[model samples]
Target: MSEILRKGDIGQAVADLQADLRRAGYAVERTAIYDNGTRDAVAALQGATGLVVDGAYGPKSRAALANFDVSRLMRESDLIAAADRLGVPLASIKAVNEVESRGRGFLADGRPVILYERHVFWKQLVAHGVDPAAYAERTAILSRQRGGYAGGAAEYVRLASAMQIHAAAAQEAASWGAFQVMGYHWKALGFADIESFVATQYRSEGDQLATFTAFVLADTTLHRALKARKWAQFARLYNGPAYAENLYDTKLARAYARFAGEESEAVA
Candidate 1:
């Protein structure tokens, strides 16, 4: 029965826990900050180990971690399958995976990685006939919380709070999984509904990759960009006009080059 390591509970122990998670093949920053990445890695670990996927490193999670084998998390075959299914190069898929989530999908609290759009949630609630005044104050609070490059844990907290107000709309208002695909795109991406889409997100990274593949395939423009190795076009379509702000195109190009180089070396 080890002590718990949860979001916002930062210390050297948390840093050590992150190190253990990373060694177990979870993509977590070793910053000791117990941020969103830490939460996601913990959730992935819990899911993989059949532990409670609460993203909290409690006694059971710690016990499971103690004996966890990192090799069990490998998904190279799945990536290849997804790339083949989409008729895109594996390097393109790998590049998107690297730029989008760096290959992690869940948060420490067992939820898929999300960026809760408070404004979007507000609009959804309004569309659903919910009184905006009921959530106005809290939405205002969440609106003021800024996200950094990788996003912040506060988005999760805000999402949790918003879910309490309107679960269905809240879920639809946020983006999910490694690809950060918006929940609203569930139908266009071939999901039966938002709930089904969210369920897939929680299943595994392979499922997330499947979702990404479906998304790319559904958008002919994005698929063409990927096939053509047009990183800028892919970034513009996938990330919007703000893509330049993050240098997403450059990142995609670099990631593609790295994966392509690896493939070339393997063939050689």
Candidate 2:
């Protein structure tokens, strides 16, 4: 028998589920109020899976959330627009998105970008322990590798907030939108950077999401080190020798290849 997991505050949960479903390219209205269609979707899902087809949100329903595909949720136009704003290659963006979230939904483990304890040592040397300044240097290095930088301060905001390295500061990103870039940073990127035809206006929320996507793609630094085939350098770039060893285990190439495989199949 189908069960209602909990009551009263089910609105928020249902809304979140609906949003995720829509993001994964399902048909869910954004009214934040779940009605019959939403219920039927839930019931149909249950029926297809041989579960009790009661039109209710429950534990089994929650578990099924993992099966929804995210690639369908985002519009292709939005994906293209976002890629241009971040100044990343569209293929790279598609690859990373496919591997990271399977085009399913927004990132699950949002965190502040930070170096691990051992990596903290190198970061001190490379980034100088000044939060903003360190990020600035990291940005410069990445810009040179990526061929150009477009997002400006707004890009930094997303990196500082959602990237795993900065997990501690993710809460500061509460007011931020989809890509989690602060509005101010979004605004600043507009005037600071000269955008061409392909580039969207920096302050655009759509652009912000794309910029954050680019940031995540670039963070791995696997692309750069792979070209050089410098194990130590790649290790330093990702974290540090120890952290990289644990993180990558087998080898940098192997781990990167794994991630690449995941990226290749991601939906827009």
Candidate 3:
């Protein structure tokens, strides 16, 4: 018997809905939160299949999903290309992938994993003639804090509030995808624009990996550090001054060693 899936649901079933939606080319994020994005995707899928567009994944929707072939979500060739382009070892790239993403990219609500910069959004609002003094406390709270969001759905809820002030600027204020690259870096990372960057982020992990490659390639110092296997330097430059607090450099080194050992074993 197929389980019913609806908005507000969480866990493995929600994750499955996201995965099958992606398989159906619905452009939903694989995050386990059944937020607006998931609801919209479900609606889109239902409309296409001539089912009742209620946005609920019931028995009928499950049957449809079962018929569609699951698409390749990531490619080894893309990873290899990114590594080669950055002039870094595959193990090094793998280390970053493992350390940075831990193998998850999108939230179940079909949005890329993001940490919206509320302080940045507030600044943008103020610049756009909105009064920050009115939302002063909220702005301060958003600025000082990070990572309380349960999933992409929660992040989007916060983002929607910011969007009430300035949509484009709010979008620009968030870090997106498995790489957690800032949207403000879109131009620097070779994306035609922020929207294009966001779209790519919504597409798949492959696009995120490509963007990460572009980001690494754009920063000569970071690229050099990566090629040299300077984990501390790389982590400091990539992750900011707080890298030591998280022991990001140490984790990178350990991950690199593990990946390199696996590679060596594969060759042997």
Candidate 4:
């Protein structure tokens, strides 16, 4: 591994490097292949720890990762783009981001915050041609009923296990990043597949917001709900039928009001 590792490289060396970066709190996955996610994480590490922002792995990055504020993943421009894409107010977009992820994506460890639902995984695997009865014993990670939320970075543990059974299915079952956009929406969001959708999560909050915008634009009803300030409808469409029980609609409305007020004042 004396050579500098860049995108398009592969092998145990790459995986090892990813492991080293992950331990240092970078979002590089241990996929044994150097993809764009790895490159971005490397570049982030480089810029954060004062190395050149080359997006390549070499001696400097290796030593720097163990030490780390990554470059900004989200920006005001991202929110504006999302609002423009949805034909809604920027306040609306900001409100959703705040409600879904407290206004930013990623964990303190630099990994995207994921919520891998067991029931979704169960159905996804079955749909992908893997029988759940084969090991119903592992209900924690595979269940018809959802409830084992480890939350935040720990959710990746459940994801890693399910990935072993079926990579694409596993990824599609989870809600990812700032907006918690489900990977199942990958195709409609314009990605080639779930793998690509999940990779973008590792990119930045802005990337996640872009996916969310795609999702809203594709679902006309959802888009209209947000545009009309129909918080209840938007919440139900976005978060499922039981949204009222969690007051997601209320939270969204309040957050929107706060941002709208601020934006209005700025205009004045």
Best model number under lDDT? 4
- Over 49-97, each residue of candidate 3 has an lDDT whose tens digit, in order, gives 5543446677556655676421323345566777888878888887887
Predictions in order: lDDT: 0.74, 0.42, 0.75, 0.80
Q: In candidate 2, what are the lDDT values of residues 102-166, reduced to their tens digit?
A: 22222233222211122222233333233544444554222212222224334444444334434
TM-score of 4: 0.70
Candidate 1, TM-score vs. the true structure?
Answer: 0.68
Candidate 1 lDDT, 87-161, residue by residue in tens: 877887777766866345666666677777766776677767987676556643234343322365667766667
Please name the candidate that would achieve the greatest TM-score relative to the true structure: 4
Where does the lowest 10-residue lDDT sum fall in candidate 1?
141-150
Query: RMSD to the native, candidate 1?
Result: 9.8
Residue 186 lDDT (model 3): 81
* Candidate number with the higher lDDT (1 or 2): 1
Query: Candidate order by TM-score, highest to lowest?
Result: 4, 1, 3, 2
Indicate the TM-score of model 2.
0.26
RMSD of 4: 13.9
Clashes of each: 6, 19, 5, 0
Instruction: After superposing candidate 3 on the true structure, give the runs of residues whose Cα lies further than 4 Å from its correct spot.
Output: 1-72, 126-151
